[model samples]
Target: MINLHWIILLPIIFGTVVKLLPLKTAKKLMVLFQAVLLVLVFVIFIEVRKNGTILENIGGWPDTISITLRADLLASAMALLTCLLFLAMLTFVQNKHYADHLFFFLFLSLESLIIGIFLSNDLFNIFVLIEAATLIITILIMYKKTNLSIYDGMMYFLINVVAMSFFLMGLGMLYKKIGVLDFYALETALSQVKDPDSMILPYAFMITAVSLKAALMPLFSWLPKAHGTPSAPSEVSAILSGLYVKTGVYLFIRLQLAFSPLINTSELFMVLGFITAIVGFVLAFAQTDIKLLLAYSTVSQIGLIMVGINMGSPQAYWGGLYHIMNHAVFKSTLFLTAGMIITEYKTRNLDEIKGVFNLMPAVGMATVISILGIVGAPLFNGSISKYLISEGSSGSWIEYGLIFINLGTIIVFIKYGQLLFGESGKKETANSDILEKAVVLGLSMLCFFGGIFGSELISILFEVNFPVEILSHGVKLLLFVGSLFLGLVIYYGLFKKKNYLAVLNAIELGFNEICLSITLFFAFMVIYLKITL
Candidate 1:
């Protein structure tokens, strides 16, 4: 009979307890802890789905005065994903040499903080948890202490510190106006207010931070460095790309919905999303580093997800949510597999590494499945989510924009697919752990079948009957196939013929540069939102 309130406490307590244990004992304890957490999250999910929502004001205090946590379908689902992803990471890292002290401490603490961010009903708590998570992640990112990793970690820290300052300022403003930071309480306060204009700046402040975290355009300067640094381990990169960033997206959904009665900026966000998506793929196309290419691809996929959710269509909203899950699975698998490939080849350059299929057949096969999913091949997870997102914008420019952006993604991957061909070079074998391989391959299969039975899976995951239209009777199939062919042509015919992409590779933003970009974006958002929303 454990309620939602105890769920947050369980992780935080165990995470702290692990800090005191010996290294070997900590690892053993962690497995047990993760098992308990998985069970707890499952139980919470069941209870939430059964009851619709679970609200707990701590210590049985009055709702008006006490801090509260909520467990609805969305929050519970996200929490469950967090648990599953954390466990997957542990299994991946278990045999790695870096599984030393502070590894468990940082990961477990970060895990609890993330779950808290998802579950907490109070804005103040969310802010604190996010800041804590950022600090821990920064430390983890710089863990290897190799090749500019310290610099990358510092940049990540400085940029996010500024972002959190924005969040804090906005939280202060909201508290001044509403006298409470609880989501429901804020809504209640807004209901009694006459002026909604005061919220625009606060929204700008908060959303800018969340947007930075989500690595949206302009503020996306930190993402490539942090997620693709040569020093950051594969699991760290995978977790950052696969899960940490989504917490920001989660906050965006939560805060925006709470302010729906005040204003709607979905249209502006849709436009911004399109720009981000296009830019993301274009930048990815110019990259030679496989990990960086994947990092940029994440930016592209996130933009598409942002576009989906902002489209004022329920089909799009659900599609966006579905894509979040899909992106997590496939992207993590790609990053992990890419990490292995990079290790085996002893290089990060996409062109230098070849014949993964011959060298590591399982890894190569996983890459093919992951690529198909990312490129939205029929009966893959990406296709289902992409099609649903398209359904919402059926005839608009946004739909067309998705096609164009996807073309860019296809071109990048077409270049990336080169690794699967050519000669399997001479190199000594390394221990390929059965567990890590199984986890990633299993996830790839989930992507495969998840698309084949998308409607059923969607109903199970979301508890709603979602009609999944695949290729829309060959119309979408034609478009995707055309894009793939065109992308390949552009890659070989146009890109290969020129040095133009070199300039794109040189565009790296510094800390001050990122700060300026954030300022410009905030100002633009304020002016534009004032005029429009």
Candidate 2:
């Protein structure tokens, strides 16, 4: 019988073998390895669908005592995403010099850790997986060995280490209070608690850690540095922006669900999510470097996802989950194509690059499709999820907030959309990498099909039916068109002539400031919980 543990174990075991093999041999072997791993993930996903949820206790110990691996619909979906992205990224970079044995080892090792995180039902086990993943990512960030890269890596490492300490402390407190680290067990115990106050401190601690991981509002300072660092490979950036950072959001969902009985702070997160969304777009519009633009955009989209998740309705909550998948596909494509553009043009500045459609049609087409998807164009994946979130938030200020956020997204992308048009002043079309182009095109197609069949996909993915009515869909389409027109005018009329956004981008938070922000965030959460509960 195929087991969940093998899904986590195969990568590590094979990665070791690949690491010791000759470079050429290892390169070919790793592809096959990823293919096999993808199959395993598919099998597990199928099993999860057949059964409600799969549960296993290591060494046959009782569920409350042993490490637990649980694969429900949510976990299975996320695990499938993990496998698919790792395979895409690995394949995307196969022909590059960077796809060496050690790199492959670290990549697959990170994959194993992330999948472990998705499957683990024990709180301590999840923490350990997160910590291990962090270490692997640090190495990957500084893989190129530059001063700037090293600085980015160390800052990422140090800040995350400090943040995860809080997670560990919270876990210690929870284990002490509940006598078990299993998620289900903890939930049962928490439901029996008479006072919500007792869990506040630990909740604050663990949530602070997760918020940082999720790049929520003030805790997101480390994200751009880690994701947009020029020294890192494009595939690394793609995975980081596309999937890795999402682990934080995923954890936030899991932890919040586990703590739902004792804590209810949806209002607080909703506010923060809105702010993060606004700030993310403003920064993205100001960026000259291509990667930083995408990085800040990730921050903005994550904030939007957070907003949807906390909208206090099933439609919006599941919409938020669906957006996670949408963002993963679109953002991954953007990053991958950006890498190709940067390589072809030898410039990361947006001003110097143009006529991508004329020079590289395949890549240009992919970029255009992804940009459309992200802007929530009427027939794109983003539109479907955004509409669902709006539907859930209908008849309130939250609805208006969603509109403004979408407008801001349009404005930011309008600036980026320039890359697809105009003349590059070059005569020859650049040779394309077939594999890379294929991957990019495939993901871009997903962005379109995901939107076209959004309702059906949501139903299939989550086993829930919340169909989009035609009248409502038409209204959203009108709203999207209005937003797009306004965004274009704002981008061309005001932003094109002025550099005000550049000033906004100049504001950078240092390490000390980030730590201070973390402290303030925790304090605010604690105080809010005390009053609200």
Candidate 3:
């Protein structure tokens, strides 16, 4: 029987063909194709749930040149989230002014690469898929034909290609030692190897490369610039912040599991995650542009996810994975909504765009839900994972660090809430269409219900004790009251003061670059140790 791996490539192939079709017909065909793809994904999700871990070896090749596609619990959950987000984005972009054929082609190509990354079992194949995704994303970023978009795309391409080169070098080292590229085979080889010395170089290189790709601080400078730019489509922002970055996290988890014995390096991950979380939010709080604020917030959220995974408990792992799904939903929704607001208001500045909620209730409501989710407010999907991550942690320092970051998240979103609700008198509502409203409503519903029943849903998917008590009663109330107060204080007191915009610009350009250089130096130290020790 043929495997579902082949099915993963269908969208890409179809998307390319669609791009070649007449522009008038392309939009209709793209929507129809994406709708069908969504249905197929749902069917695949069902099949995977019924039968544990679907794996297919291509061309009957068991050991060499075998392309393996497998869906574990994590992969299925991610795929589901991706498909849903993609659908919402499609709806939003369907009516917007753009080359419909090219846009859909790039979008589907991105989807194909993401699926390929998630489902593949070979390290080499994962690298290839990641490169493919990056190339497609670069094209998407530059698709708008603006100077800012072109510059951002070039920067993104250069940085990511460098990162991938390091990853390829690491893969080469691993292949030299093990003679196999499959993750399972590499795991077996590492377990069988006697000397730990030979393993350290490849391991360190791989981890660093993954960290860079994932946008862990201080390697996160490129992200805010690349993701914060206005030239890319809103849907592309969703994919970049939502699904694409998570690929690195997934690889980290898989590798950590495979090399559990040789690699007891969670402490490094913990420290890096803590710093990243703190820095991310601090930077986020300083941004004037709403999209940049949200982009930095993504950095902070990704940091929190890493903290959960680095905690090294099964509960932490589960929470990390759960948060991945929740973050994707909320973050993508928020970005899309932001795009809608920008499209309507003709401005990305929060100060100029007053009384937005009064103008677009649907968009406002969606933004409110997404903000609450990010803040870990009660009965929301984000709170469940946040609670799990915090309580699942054993160390006091780590737990407290997470709490402080959560507080900072509250502060950042509080500014957003203030911008939405506080500055109400200014008129001038930008015109918006029906499709935009539909997109916002669709995502809002997901975040709302996803929060309300997160525990039950995750429990069924994970087949573990979902810890409803902490999620329902404890963290929700604490975060709500705490964040609300912090937000009020920060907005009313601090942010209302002088020209912090210059400071924010400096941080975005100067400080972040310094941090990135420092991180690269540390990575080099690890390489040096591998060579010497």
Estimate the Cα RMSD of every predicted model relative to the unseen true structure. 1.8, 1.1, 2.6
Please give, for residues 1-533, the per-residue lDDT of candidate 2 as tens digits.
47888888889889898777888788777877888888887888788777789998889999998888999998889988888888788778879987787888898999899889989999899899999998999999999999999999999998999899988999899888879878898889899999899999999999999999999998998999999998889998899899988899998988888899989888889889989998998889889899999999999999999999998989999999999999999999999999999999999999899999999999999999999999999889999889888999999898998999999999888888889899988999989799899999998999999999999988877899988899999999899999999998888889887758798776888889888898898899889888888
Comparing 2 with 3 on lDDT, the higher-scoring candidate is 2
Which segments of model 1 are wrong by more than 4 Å?
16-25, 427-431, 470-473, 497-499
- In Å, residue 476's CA in model 3 sits off its true spot by 4.6
Candidate 3 worst ten-residue window by lDDT: 507-516
Structural similarity to truth (TM-score) of each candidate: 0.96, 0.98, 0.93
Report the lDDT tens digits of candidate 1 across residue range 1-533.
67666666676677677778777777767777787789889988888878788888888877757878888888898899888888877777777788775777788778888888899998888988888888999999899887599989988988999999999998999888788888987877877767777888888899899899888887787899999999788988988898888998899999888888877888878888888898898888888899999999999998999999999988888889989988988898899999888878899998798888888878888999999999999889998889889888988988888889889889889888989998867564445678778778877897898689877767767887767544473798899999998988888888866636768888888888899898888888799778875
Model 2: CA > 4 A from native: none
For model 3, residues 1-533, the per-residue Cα lDDT tens digits are 33577557887898878767787677777767778777787677777777877888888898546987778777877776777777777777877788577778788878888888888888999999998888888889888989989888888887778777777887899889888887777778778878877777677778777887788877888887678888788888878997788988999888887767565677778778888888898888888788888999999999999998888777777788888988888888888888888877778887677666787778888899888888888778887788788777746688778778998898788776655664555475546778878877777777778778887777767767765674445655865697678768866787666536437567444444634663574567476556554
Please report how far candidate 2 places residue 262 from its true position, in Å: 1.2
Q: What lDDT is reached at residue 356 by model 3? A: 66
Model 1: how far residue 381 lies from native, Å: 0.8
RMSD of 3: 2.6
In angstroms, how far off is 128's CA in candidate 3? 1.2
Q: lDDT at 470 for candidate 1? A: 40
Candidate 3: give the clashing pairs: 380-451, 381-451
- Give lDDT for model 1: 0.85
